[model samples]
Target: MQLANYLFFTTGCEQALAFYAACGLGEVTELKRYGRDGQPPTAAMEGKVMHARFEGPGVLFYASDNHDAEPMRGSAHILMLEDRGETARLFGQLAEGGTVTTPLGIQPWGDYYGKLTDRFGVQWMLNCRL
Candidate 1:
């Protein structure tokens, strides 16, 4: 399975998207607004992104706006895996003797995904498109 990076923007995703696009990271391949999901954003998150994906020759970046999120610090990267089998295997290995914040399972977003803090104290996110 191939690996990709995912990002989360507690706020200011629009500006971040613009900045990265201008920096030539890649084109904005897909964008989904919160309201488009039939779940309108609150006043603070109005016009903000529910999800945005950027793609380049060897890069994939995903981001979303979180209006009520706590101040983000450090890296919030998700290690995205493309194959379900590999994702499950690696997630099992990583969760061994570690904390599983979210059990591996199918999510409404059309993927099998999970979150954990590995034994080495590193956070991880494993994903496989369904």
Candidate 2:
């Protein structure tokens, strides 16, 4: 298992992803545009971000547009991990004392990752690099 941190953006996911990339965070991978899929997206989500991934030294982050236009709140950044074994170990430890939002598995981005919030309400992200 490997893990990476995640951030959820409200609408301007593409811009945010580019900004972070410009900030020297890491190379942006899987920068997807919603309507670019060649499918008819909803009228409200024609050009939004369907998914985006970024990588930096010891950091991996993901983002997507909120289709509902709901406001993103709270501080829910994931704690990305580098090694699958380390991620699995950490997942077990955290789940033992918290809740798993997403079970570890092969994500659409072709990486193994998971999400969980510890007992203290702190969210964690685990990832295994592909």
Candidate 3:
């Protein structure tokens, strides 16, 4: 069995994937739009991507536009907290048995930033934009 991340976007899957490629994440190997799905397209689905495969240096995932549903949450996490104490607390909790890739502290970018992988292998990123 193979495991892959699938992302659902309400719209602009193409543009989002383009941005990802620009960020050196990955490039879309194949893109299929709703209008060309061998099914009649509705006005709302005309320019939306039905499915797309993206592959890059270390990432392989699929993305699609689902006009009626909210976007799916992926393994990556970004937490923006305003409370220093709370931030530290959560950081400690997430760091329990997992590896802390980046220590939680004020970064050169002038924000409290850190990254960690939970015991379950999920990655998390925290940023307290000061």
lDDT of 1 by residue, 15-125 (tens): 666655554446788888876766688877777788888887545877778865543445444657677887787777767667898899999897899988754344667
> What TM-score do all the candidates reach, one by one?
0.51, 0.50, 0.57
RMSD of each: 12.0, 11.2, 11.5
Q: Which stretches of candidate 3 lie over 4 Å from their true place?
A: 74-130
Candidate 2, residues 33-113, lDDT tens digits: the string is: 778976567777788877778887766777777665444346566556667876787677666657898999889998889
Which residue pairs clash within candidate 1?
Answer: none
lDDT of 2 at 1: 83
Flag regions of model 2 displaced more than 4 Å.
Answer: 69-130
**Distance from true location, Cα of 45 in model 2, Å:** 1.1
Best candidate, lDDT: 3
Model 3 C-alpha lDDT per residue in residues 14-124, reported as the tens digit of each score: 776776565445699998888787656778988688989999754688888886755333567566777777678777777677789899999999999899875544566
Clashing pairs in 3: none
Candidate ranking under TM-score, highest first, comes to 3, 1, 2
Candidate 3 least-lDDT 10 residues: 69-78
CA lDDT of every candidate: 0.70, 0.69, 0.75
